[model samples]
Target chain A: MSDDVAKFLDADIPDPTDFPADAPGLRQLDEALRCTMCRELFEAPVTVNCPHGHCFCSMCIRTALATKDECPLCRHAIREVHLRRNTAVEDAVRAWGLARTFVLQVLREKEEAKAATVASKYFSGKPKSKKRRRTPELSSDDEVVEVGERNVSHSLKGHTSSSSSGVVPCPICNKSVPMQNINNHIDQGCPSPKDADLDVLLSPSSKSKGKQKQEWSKLFQGGGAGSATTGSKKGKGKSRGADQDADPLPKIAYDTVTQKRLREILEELDLPTTGDRATMSARHSRWVNMFNANLDASPSQRKSVKQLMLELRRWEEAEEKKKTRAKLDAKDFDSGQYQKDNKTTFARLVEAAKPKAPKKSQSPHEGPPASSLSPSDGDSIAPPRRTEVVTIED
Target chain B: MFEAGPVSEADFFTWEALIMGPKDTPFEGGVFAARLTFPADYPLSPFKMKFDPPLFHPNVYADGTVCISILHTPGDDPTMYEAASERWSPVQSVEKVLLSVISMLAEPNLESGANIDCCKLYRDNKAEYERIVREGIKAQLGL
Candidate 1:
């Protein structure tokens, strides 16, 4: 069931390694890479010429420009057009995204190796020669090649060698035994081990690998993912035999296109066409982003258009709801401006509410009697008057 | 992490920061320590910045609380002095606030003086005001 959903939804390849997301080094890297404005990984990063040298994603700066012309960091006057795209930062973010997976894999392997060593020490009755040879080799390689190709190759060699000895490591207990006896070892020999480890080692990879191979074959037939899918679908289902790649879809001239035609085009693409022209345009842009983002994903995880459309619709609804809520909240309260403008009326209400002050003091001839009152009395009376006014206004 | 100021957190909600006064200002060469108390709904509401051993500045009240437009709520201004855009917004972080405070020290807004006496002195006798401010900085430093 999930396989079908995965086909339509751009699924991220779940990291095969056991690296924790919150590992301190990874967290620090995440923070460093995050845009100052959106607090997310930089997308089309741009640096503003502020004194403080703050950088924000392009979208964030555009949004900030709508309200304030000043830099968010230093309040120095900055125009959106003046923002220079930080190619260096953009490259850094791209490199980090690709490197993150490899780094996590290496770290998880190192951690597992350490755990295996500790377990070997605890279970000392096992053949000491195998343990001694493996420990020094693993530790030396770990220290020498902490983050390069050498470490991965070394680990791969270690796995092959252990397998060659008619012994496959019981993944659960990290114990080496014959491949034929591995299942029996796990069932009877190893103490109650984490079931998750077994599942991780066994299931998802085999299923995902098959799906990946199918995707690769599809890619080769189609030429490019985007053009191929659109061409095949648009060819009235008869051009399946055409070995040549189709031309890319013509860009829709939204301004020139009639609303009816636009809606029809959207319908053809299996996209939602329920909203107004602006919303439709927004939906279309979001669809393009989803489509392009899916194409950018590893071949195995590329999503179908139908799934991308569904995602776009969900996102649009969420954004619409958030905007409506903010509008309602802003409209509900005037933030004490009303009280400040109507101070006299509030003072009168306060005087009226007070336990019938002497008529002589409250007389119209007293000429704004608040000034005549003692400073202490005036201070005591002012706050309640403002609060009372606010309540009445509400 | 600041070079001009070192910030130490008492907790997530409370922080103490020592700011070195900006160069070529009356406040230059002084290390002013202030406490920033973040409300539970911080970023939504601005943090309260209070200088320890209050500095006599037009924007700082006698009680040591610094009054700046950036520290005001991102709502309709009751005083009508600051635009809503100039007031606090969630996008404004703690680093921005500290930089703003330092800038505020260099260029005091005498129009809305929280310290009335300092405002009057600053307006009437610029030299005397500078001398007095220098003395205040010296006293804080025990010079």
Candidate 2:
């Protein structure tokens, strides 16, 4: 069964060795060779050297590193040492030539199956995203508010992929998810092994005892990593007058409630409310002059304005992080990934290039069918000169 | 970034590499020392690696920097044969590149290389090139 499925995927992939012959245990190494965002073979794959697989594409990984050198997928510490190519894998590849053809047929078959499944669903009337499937879980359809602004109509269609049937039970752990989701699992997306009631990934001592050790360390000024990041700035960091200098334009209609709200917002960051008492008194005196400007808007509008600012800040930070990760992956992703193996060709190459016949000859049961389009171009790849076009793989 | 190379007599800008005759290939048991001169923009630009005792092969450059697709810099090349990924980039290190070079010596991608004379000699005039390669390997190995 494993051979069949492996053969299927390999049938098309140009470089068969790129996929782990034994997947489960080497998931991290496998994931490291691929791009996280693209969910395919990397154009320039980069590895995050974590004991637990926390791999991401180089470009994504590098962008994330700008904030900190942590793997984008699982936040593991990334060291330069992890950047070395898997030489054993490379040697196997140098020997393998190009990928096979049968793997492509299975992939194509899988695609057809998925297209068939999507067409049968009730939501197919309108083209909707997979996220919209099984809408609202509401019995009364009219009550459920559709997601979107006034102009756009929305539809929900849940989708299952084509490679659904008889996927090889993952060789590593007996457990198997779709092959497409393997990298995610390896890179933090995989349910924590500790999450399984059956297996304890880390012994209980490692978790609780480690936490206690951290707390003791924090007391000694070793502080948490976040604090350490702001390290060596004990004297020169924040200004001494920082607390007293905040909310300078105070008493502008500084009603008790408004003052409380402002205090609540500012206090989140432990900022100051006012300067000297004289400064406070001056602001209060000016309250008579400026109260209307502060209070003109309705309370909800003011609250909403604050919320909007907070939300915007959150989005901006997230965007910044996203861009950082993207840059990292771009910079590092696909560094060694050869360009010939896009998923389609990768699957095809794998199929075409399988070891002529694995030990036990099967009943020849018409293994898998060929692609409908008929690769009239034939099996040869664009000769070695054209070998450098990097393709993202799954 | 600068560490003394493994072999003595090897310089940083131009290091000496002992290319072991790949086992079972036509150039077997032959020890070939080559000169690898990295450009100022090396890792970005392809490094020039040439046999000290020059010999004939299809993919080798006239000056002896490897002309394999993997060694081409991923920049605008006047020739359209190589893709950006196939070209050399700063990310590539000496180890990976040497691996590719070794592969090229064994494989000799003849399609793109226009060294028709050397290629013809290699394919049709096999006995001659082999003898030359074998003798060059002898000089490089000091054997």
Candidate 3:
């Protein structure tokens, strides 16, 4: 195999085997996070309304449903309309994605620590007595580990020594500001205040805390208002949240529609209209499926229209390449080899055709009738000169 | 019971495979060769599998093509006896199909036999069927 193909095949997929045998929960966690259809981490996961509430990546289920209406897991009847955004599972996946590397790091560290203890015990002569005496010290060692954990967290949060010191660094513009004023400084897009020292002395922390509370309450009030409106307008239009005003696209009955109408649909979606009728229908149908599935995702996780178009273009290009490759393969076909391979089938067909003469006049004898009609049938079968011309054209 | 991969690195749609005949059956200890032809939109459509130098079994056609419910899609039911649940779905993979084929070799579903001659021979003269199958295996192995 070529190095590139070998490397492509060697790409790592996170599986239960990545964890040590002792940690069973981590393995299950990894498995649970994967979509059953694609066997990859769920992307925009959505839950079906079945009794089991099976969750799958929105795109995966949508594609599967496009083929068959039943659920891939339990084989229960399901519809695209019953799919709901599974925000809880989505949040869990997001949190797991962030913590996976750190969890792996900690597990490796613990393994190394255990190995170091084992080596120390092996090297020392009085292992039992030393272990007994060091029990009390181990408690203090845990305290030191706790402190080490805090340091690691501080470093991860980019705070470093800022927790002990009053000055906090502005994350965006990278300037030191008072701890109390950091939020306001960030709220103002990290602009240098005209009188920073004066402002810190004048504005007490209490006022800033009250302002943060007001912002939180305002956010809740907005959410409540949005929910009330959505509740009232639920059946009229299934639009949810502020940004998701685009309703899910209904499936098109491609058979009933004319090619012109299909082109109009493509044009309506701002998609390219250059392909043939079949290609256009395939492109539009796939786009509708993707667009409808995108509506099932939480608004934050939804892909933009441009990204969907790009995906559609990529799919169309792949399909085009496959079609051309199929044509080339047909051109490369060795008819002689094919006939040789299927010789029995050809012989059987010839045998069936030959028996037609026997059917016309049979004294319950096959050979005599065939022999009697051979001259006329021979003349009738002598049209190969036309087939020779067709072969040249091919 | 079987291992399969692309016939060549450049073409993933065509695969070459080797299946060891299931134990405790007439076909036992015989290694069979097969080819799998996958559609461009696979997992949505089922692949085609045919044993090379066709096995002498009721479920295999004279031309070596396999006749199994799982390899047929839900819509393309020529036999009309297979249930929708037993037919191909996107969830069914090549591994599942191979495993099903192994069981099929052990216990052929004679109700929907692809080779009538084999099915009749199997039902009427059991010893003759086994002798034919064993001889075919020996000939395949050049033993």
Candidate 4:
């Protein structure tokens, strides 16, 4: 195989470029809804309580604050407590989420229609001059029809019911099929009209929406149980009663906490206390950040405790690997220089170890070996010679 | 413009970069080959960058590690010379590091010199220092 590295980009992810070049306004609109830190469309977006009032994904801001108690964009002094739900932005994001796939499909159709029109004009035996003049008028009309209110209402109608000639994504396969043909398409096991782009755009979103609803309902139940603790616990005690409240977890003073106390805390959270004191403290702090961040998210968007725990474990594993790699690198970096720096200590250690072997043998049988050393100085010039029977013969 | 990507598809932790030396400096016209090794906890912790063949500059160590305040973490002020505000934070990225290093090449920070010989030559004999740097680049290019 060629030595050239594989070039890849996350081209599938919805980005500002999803809007065509002509729609710079729409592109900017798409960009405005994204979190700067994660560079993804905002999920559970929160406005930083600063003069700048910058918005970020709830998890993004919480993770940033955990590292440094300031805004990532403006460096304004901030804390997790300062974050407030930006419901206006949330609604905007939600509306955009539903509109995004529809817009993309419509845009794609419009482009195809333009291209087909252009091709027919070029290839057909029509007068070139006459065709050129008519093409502009035709294009302008198409733009007004496709991009204006008429197309949106038509698509919405098709989305709800497959009666009109307007296109709707097939429920089973998610391809943009003509509204009238959706039932036939599914009846034939979604065989044809293989529009992969629309499928890719629409299917994931529908799936995520379902998953999100399930998680929201689960969280809602847990929250309800938490509120009615006395009654709910009697029915089902599975609810994560510890973290259902709205209050943020108090920050742990990692430096002051004993290892035993930290391990106990980890155990209470059902977390692995496998790493050292420092690791345990770091893990606990990270868990707190994640837990509090989940609380910040809208109840419908909050992840389950099990999901959060899995994320924590994954993060810790990655971090632990990095730490071990760094340690190994430090040991391997300029080995000769490292040896030189510790040469004296190494020499002292060797010297300390030399006398211990002789003392171990002599201590079991010989009493007051120090006193015997002066009397046997005539033959005790070498310590090994004095312990010859044990050293070699024995 | 500087360009960088992973050296191999299997290993994202290490990246190879081609940085154009800042214009109007001794290092101008030199296309430096540098390696960026990112820790697993990247963006949270800054990556380590080094010139492969090593650059002869005061702020660059003989081993080619860049000695700039922006690359150093807040907890890593061994010399106690850099201010906390100037040090690396989560907000810093590879692009910022690249820009800082380019500026560093244009004007070396003598306060925290990495190469004592280069620093001394730069301070005591500016003409000789630039001449040596140019000659070194010429030798590297086999010109």
User: How high is the CA lDDT of each candidate model?
Assistant: 0.57, 0.41, 0.66, 0.65
Pairs of colliding residues, candidate 1: none
Q: Model 2, range B54-122, lDDT digits (tens) per residue?
A: 545687766555567666544446768775446554344565566676677777776777466878888
lDDT score for residue A308 of model 4: 65
Q: What ordering of candidates by DockQ runs from best to worst?
A: 3, 4, 1, 2
| Model 4 CA deviation exceeding 4 Å by range | A1-11, A17-22, A105-246, A272-279, A320-394, B78-84, B123-125
Per-residue lDDT, model 3, residue A40, is 60
Best of the two (2, 4) by lDDT: 4
Which scores better on TM-score, 2 or 3?
3
TM for candidate 1 is 0.36
lDDT value, residue A343 of candidate 1:
92
TM-score of 4: 0.63
| Between candidates 2 and 3, the lDDT winner | 3
For model 4, how does the per-residue alpha-carbon lDDT over A1-394 read when each residue is reduced to its tens digit? 1122222222243667779879658888888987776666777789997789999888777777767777776767887787898878876875676577778877776666556555654577465446456567666566555555555566667656654758876543345888777567644545533334323322334333344333333333343443454352222112345444556667888888888999777655555567689878888888887777777655544555655654565465456545666776775678887899999999999999987766345433311223322221111010011111111111
On DockQ, who's better, 3 or 4?
Answer: 3
How well does each candidate superpose onto the true structure, as a TM-score? 0.36, 0.29, 0.64, 0.63
Off by over 4 Å in 2: A1-394, B1-13, B39-46, B139-143
Candidate 3: residue A105 lDDT (0-100): 59
Local accuracy of candidate 3 as per-residue lDDT tens digits, B42-121: 66678899987678899999989999999987778776788878888766677778889989999988889999999999
**Residue-wise C-alpha lDDT for candidate 3, range A1-394, written one tens digit per residue:** 2554455447443554577868869988978987876666677789887778999888878888888888877778898889988889877876676456557756666555555554554566454445555575575366455655654555556543445458755543346887777667655534433434423323344243444233323322343454454454432222223326777777788899999998777655545566678877888888887887777655655655534544565465567656766765675778898899999999999989985765455433211122222222111111111112112222
What DockQ does each candidate score versus the true complex, computed on alpha carbons? 0.09, 0.04, 0.23, 0.17
Stretches of candidate 1 above 4 Å error?
A: A1-98, A101-394, B1-10
User: RMSD, each candidate, Å?
Assistant: 18.1, 24.9, 19.6, 20.4
How much DockQ does model 2 earn?
Answer: 0.04
Listed per prediction, chain B TM-scores read 0.91, 0.73, 0.96, 0.96
